[model samples]
Target: MTDAILRMRGITKTFPGVNALADVDLTVRRGEIHAICGENGAGKSTLMKVLSGVYPHGSYEGEIHFGGEPCRFTGIHDSERHGIVIIHQELALCPQLSIAENIFLGNERAGRGGGADASGRARHGRGRGGLGRLLPGLRLVDWNRTNHEAARLLERVGLPENPVTPIADLGVGKQQLVEIAKALSKRVRLLILDEPTAALNDEDSAHLLDLVRGLRDEGITSLIISHKLNEVLAIADSVSILRDGRMIETLDPSAGTVTEDRIIAGMVGRDLEHRFPPHEPRIGEEVLRIEDWTVHSPARHDRAVVSGAALRLRRGEIVGLAGLMGAGRTELAMSVFGRSYGTGISGRLYKDGKPIEARSVREAIRHGIAYATEDRKRYGLNLIEDVKRNVSAAGLDRLARRGWVNGHEEYRVAEEYRTGLNVKAPSVLSETGKLSGGNQQKVVLAKWIFTDPDVLILDEPTRGIDVGAKYEIYSIINRLADEGKAILLISSELPELLGMCDRIYTMAAGRITAEVPRAEATQERLMSHMTKEQEQVG
Candidate 1:
């Protein structure tokens, strides 16, 4: 029997009016990959936070045992001292900093005069240290030595050796690897990864999973929290299900009894016949059309993100744009929605076969177009604002009279959608940022739906949301289509696209490579188009 590396008993966490976790118990064995599965807001993150000391000792009721010793970690630093590290779903690395600097940020070296410097030689890099004395140790950084260590750590996490590169320069997958490297920098006995591959492409996700298995071989234990069932089955040796912040069961993966359905059943307390509802096509006339659309990347010159892309969305149809990361599906949607993403965009759009000019977001909305961005926190919704403000933001002009905002009108508008969309929030005045990711996404959706758009472009609409929330969003999409709204769905999950869309268009290198109808689309065909393979010469 493998030795248990970490154990939590009767872990109960409570917030103002909600029980985040209740009697949750999890046992992670040494050198094994243990996966935690649950729906969104099921308390997966809260449970991890408890274990990693994010909630601290007295803040929550729990008993944590790490490596056979009871622990009461006051903060993240305290947990790190005991070789416990967690890489959250949202990476904690500074995008502006170099890979090396991000890895050694709080643990940086200082000059002889106690000034911050990265030129020092290497010394005690293990565990966390106070920021005050960090600067005085600059002489110990040793760029060459730090780079060598960083390179080795990156290799361990299946990343390329480029420590000097800025964190922003790397792709999401690479940045995730850097997060893992940072965690591994400390003498991590147990590593906790929350949605590590959520943003990664298939190739990158596969590589990260492989690295997890590699880490297990190296005698390092891991706790993986992910929504990707196939990925959990691929890498996990043991699987634990959490529901409503409580542990349901822990099953051995090698027993051959554990299946995706079983995991879902354990998670939701009922059998889910299908992960997605069956789709029936009710095709209609084209409501939106794009001709010879092209967009240059804002960050890169001489690069076209969307190159002569042409597509059509008919009323009562959901057209899915499927592609690998960097394929420009989001860019194309953003540029079409009012040139919100790129520069030098040239696209001729037609509404009901009549040319329509949309130079900005307002113009796009005025022309009955609404776009829900993938990155809800950064682009879709203002986190600091309340649900009422966020939901009524895009359509504030409708609620305004003579340049004086009508508070009651806005509240009524927000209340209508809040109830209509089944948004779970304390009140309309609740801050959008305080809501769970699923709720936040719903607010963004509510905002767009309020626009009464003829054509709605949903970019990764269900990304990072829970399965329950996904079902709601899916149902909303179907209803919108049934109501004769033209919907353009861009998603990374092929299954989602296949399940919800009437037709799926696969993109490769900023161009539509294949258009597969719901009747014909398959994972095999879609993946073929998504992979970056050179086009054959005639």
Candidate 2:
């Protein structure tokens, strides 16, 4: 028997005008946690999709060897049948279903001969035409048995005891644990996790990493794909780097040579002297100010998402709101921007020196405020629309003459922003959905920039984008600040906050707990504020 449990040789995949993967090779040892690191568009997800049968057999050129046997997977079900399961970057559970139901969705057991396996056999045995042959069949599903099995799987993945709980009630971290439990329920041998901790807080991320280590000890091999270098350094046994669809190199993490800087250099193909550009703080007059901003949740409960939050932004300054998930950073931004989210919002806004009221999104735009959402796909861009339409969506009123849009004017504006932002697409007529994640984010930025807002609220601006693209975004942000635009940047990455913002406000439990200037901000200090627990109200 071979030492390696999984191997891919000469893998190559292509899309229209793009080579997603080129002659890539990978080998996974038995019971080891291997990591794949790359920037966005670096072919990590594409390679995993091929392994998990999302690309299937004939679509890509590659040979997959599992347990020393050559295998061809036709679909995800084919891979799952052979104990090779992949958990995607996005969790794939039905929000309304219970944990037990989701875990045994396709693999259910029936009494005697009537469950999923039995139904298949019964259907095949119908041709035999014997009542006695099917007489012993039982079709009733036992809830007790299903719950027992699901509980075991959940325990293995370190989830709390709640098999009957709906997935929607859980946080992203716990929901990720449910995904791991679902994978383990299939008795998987080779498990793949793509950006497992991307949205998780530090404590939750550490717990998930510990679970991965435990899985390795129990003889389950793993392949992890992530951009966070620190987590890679902590959990990986060996690491592989990919650049522009080609395998750069694989290094042993234990060899004392695979530093975070080394891996970054390999991914980007250059030494980064400074991840953030230098800024000259010529912060001018106050551009935006909010006082006693409070927004209630849309749910029945009168929970305040943004509780008495107040802040100010100066022209030519980038201020960051640093917080863990659910800390109301995005909520505060959205609520202030034309009451787009939340209700019972009461806030006083001042533009320049005079007080103004923004009752709707259009009103907010009229007052020179623009908000770029974290979820660019859902809230920012119309995926079916072309680049020209998306860029001019915000300022369509200005582009119209006698209630009719001027196509020439629209195209001219889009062309100018596309060129300025360096958006890489075939043409402005290309569908927004067809672009890469990085470029899609750029289009969102372009749309908001077209609004010509005096104050811009960017929520997680670089989320899900690649390192190279993130650098471009960072540069763009600095240029905006240099051009005297006040930016409120909200991000989970401490380094990014420190690198770009002149001042950082640390939020915890829907309140700003601490404020730190750029010169005094450190990862340790910022994290201290982020994790500080709020006192329970009586």
Candidate 3:
């Protein structure tokens, strides 16, 4: 085997009150795909951040070796200069810019050659510099060269679209491709993808895996961090497991020895008997129903983002809404929850066979309905606040007396949820932003549950969390259903929907194409309807 391209020895990172990493070690070979798997709060992302210089050299105690040479990177730009690029879980793309502009955003062709106008040609001896040189000076950008190069990179990533297209018009999967293309433009030798397929659909994720393999064949090393054990076992040449910020073991799946169960055991320190908890559903009368619901795009009034969609949630029932990216499942949920999203919304919402007026967020809560947004970091939690404040944010009225919050009551309420949800935090005073993805999600759930809503709309509840955390969240959902709270689960993972939902609704192109019961629902059956495009009738 070739020598290690990247190595870290005796790495340790500490926060104010937490020792996030303790005596960690990792080694990655050249031109191989290495995957890091762990439970939430296991320090996977923190380790990567340290490597990529987001934490910098002095911030953490560690020794890093790249290409057999000790290196101390002071910042992300310094790491990028050495042919290392990182694509974070949350995409970092500017929605207002065109594809070509976004690709070459920071690294413009300003000082590079090729970007010259006609006026600059006559100024600095035009023919003196020959080809590849700009004609002296032109402050304006060369759109032609920029778009042409961007198109080549876009094609290389298998994205078929015009380079002039606005980023806002593209879906999440396409946005991910753009992120990869941007990384390629940086001439990256070692690419680090953190939860690359966390939000992708089945087809898009497969294509991405194929692309990663192709990159490996082309001699580019990759370090992927994912919660999906199957993908890690399938694509990684070596798998490294982390638990509570410590290195567990590294396994090579090509030896035909390691399995998903083994990896799960390593992550959680024990065997997991089942993925989903047992549930005895007692579905009763309908709690919430939407009829002929339609929502127009907030960006374009002429465009209808969701078209003629209808769904129902009965008491004590867990229903799944399955679809690919841009399928409008989120839009449907948001629009119904007090018209939080979309303009020109037309819908009829009935609770207990009677129409309810949910014209605003306050009214929506009053009507006993709650919606958890898919983008938790953005809309779900006040990241800067402590867990206690965030947990009680949704139901502040319950802890308020004469419009003033009662401190003791608030603390008691937050502590109850902190213990009940099994949130991994030192105390309720822990910052919401400082917690890991799974704990943050639990806090979001706590906030909504405090509202005591009879109907809950959970969108991508376990999108980026690890398997152990996912199981816990699933158990919580089952417990909620057992308590007669109606749940509408929106997920991109078909297996999750099939495993946890009593009935599944397949949506495509903003429409509910098919509805299948648990007895008949499968990934294949749901996917068939999910990818079915709306027929054009002239």
Estimate every model's Cα lDDT from 0 to 1. Answer: 0.85, 0.87, 0.88
Ranking by TM-score: 1, 2, 3
Give the per-residue lDDT digits (tens) of candidate 1, residues 1-538. 2889888998999998899899888888989999999988888989988888889999988799999999999999999989989998889989887888888778653323322223343444322443335644334444555666777888778777578788878888888889889888887888999998888888899888888888889898999998888889989999999888788899898999888888989988998788886556577898998988989988886899888888888999999999998888998998998888898888689999999999999999999999999899998899999999999889888888998879998999899889988889989999899887778888998999988999999998888876777888888888888889999999999889888888888788888777788889999988987775344111
TM-score (C-alpha, index-matched) for candidate 3 = 0.89
* Model 3, span 1-538: residue lDDT tens: 3779899998999998889999999999999999998998898989998999999999899799998989799999989888789999888899988887888888764433344332222222223364324544534456656778888999999999888888988977788889889989999888999999887877889999999998899888999999888888889999999999999999999999999999999999999887788787899889998888889998899999888888889999999998888889999999988899999998788999999889899999999999989889999999999999999998999999899999989999999999999998889999999888889999999999999999999999998888888998999999899899999999987888988999998888989888899999988888888899643111
Which segments of model 1 are wrong by more than 4 Å? Answer: 109-140, 532-538
lDDT of 3: 0.88
Q: Sort all candidates by lDDT, best to worst.
A: 3, 2, 1
Clashing pairs in 3: none
Winner on TM-score between 2 and 3 is 2
Estimate, for each residue in 436-478, the C-alpha lDDT of model 2 and write its tens digit.
8889999999999999999999998998776778889998898
Number of the predicted model whose TM-score against the real structure is largest: 1
- Among these predicted structures, which one has the highest lDDT? 3
